[model samples]
Target: MIDKERLPQVAYQVMNEVHEEEVDLLNRLENELSDEVLDISKVDELLNTLLEHTKEHFANEERLMQEVFFPAMMMHQGEHIRVINEMKMVVNRWELTRDPELIREYFLGTLIEWLMLHINTMDTITAQFITMHKGGH
Candidate 1:
């Protein structure tokens, strides 16, 4: 499990809120996978929810970047797009195979790693830019 305590402090309320949501979703997925009898349907539902939330979160961040005229907006948005595309591919694989273990591996390995790196780097910079430009946290 990715320790929430290790997550970088963004100090931006909206970004932090979205980060918390992401953390909650990841933790919930991890807990669900720990069950003895894997519930494919429930895991599917959770993945869908996470995907939708991630889309919204990325959109919101992009909007904020535009509002603040953040210099790294394009690069940040590109990363968001790449992550979403990868997630879609994983979802497609899940739909075809319905393999709980595969999905769990993707979540624990690819998704979690990408998310942590993104939050710690891109998000941290974005939050700093917003707070600096917008004035006051």
Candidate 2:
């Protein structure tokens, strides 16, 4: 597992623990790293962490859809599949480069942006749908 440490809250998850894994890494990077230990290993870990994050988020969203009998479920599932494929392609390229910095940069810049957009758009909808359909306590 990439980023053995739990992460900090980068996404807009209603749950706090959900953000812990990434938060831990943010803290670690801030404390450690002397331009030497920062190698492709970190990149590999972050990539794996990203893949895991994607999987978890996708699974949760799909589960919600299945429970709700969501109409746009197919479209959302398609998007999740596309995201996995796109990230894998990027990971494949980064793998060829053998540069941790490139991976870090990609994750920080592009991945974060893509993730935020997805969360704001798709994730938000899922959460709202679930909450609304649940008959509000």
Candidate 3:
């Protein structure tokens, strides 16, 4: 479970709300993975949901950055692309192997760590930039 209090605040309300939603999805995924029976379908569903949500979240952020003409848009967008590819790889692996332990390690370790770091760094800076430039956007 993610500690909401630990999540860093951003200058944008929408960004913060979207991040909270992401955290909620992650928490739900964690719960699903922790089940004793290991429902492959549930995990698959959650993984898909998370991927879709992430894509949408990135798209929204990218649009906002574009609106503000954010200088680091390319770099931040590159990171988004990289993460999306990584997520797709994990989902494909899950489909092929259905390995609970592997997925658990990924979500609990790599995915979570990357998300936290990205939020603290790229997202924080981007939100600040947007807030500074965005007028009614």
TM-scores for all candidates?
0.93, 0.69, 0.96
Off by over 4 Å in 2: 1-37, 135-137
Clashes of each: 0, 8, 0
TM-score preference between candidates 1 and 3, better one: 3
lDDT of each: 0.87, 0.61, 0.90
Q: What TM-score quantifies how close candidate 2 is to the native fold?
A: 0.69
How many Å off is the CA of 81 in candidate 2?
A: 1.2
Stretches off by above 4 angstroms in model 3 are 135-137
State how far residue 44 of model 3 sits from its true place (Å).
Answer: 0.9
- If both were scored by TM-score, which would come out higher, candidate 2 or candidate 3? 3
The ten-residue window of minimal lDDT in model 3 covers: 128-137
- On lDDT, the leading prediction is 3
Backbone clashes in model 2:
8
User: Given candidate 1, what's the lDDT at residue 133?
Assistant: 84
Q: How big is the positional error of residue 28 in model 2, measured in Å on the Cα after superposition?
A: 6.3
In the range 2-105, model 2's lDDT, one tens digit per residue, is 34232223223442344445445433433333365665576567567767876786776688679888778898899889878877887898889775565556
Off by over 4 Å in 1: none
Candidate 1, clashing residue pairs? none
RMSD, one per candidate, in order:
1.3, 5.4, 1.3
lDDT leaderboard ranking: 3, 1, 2
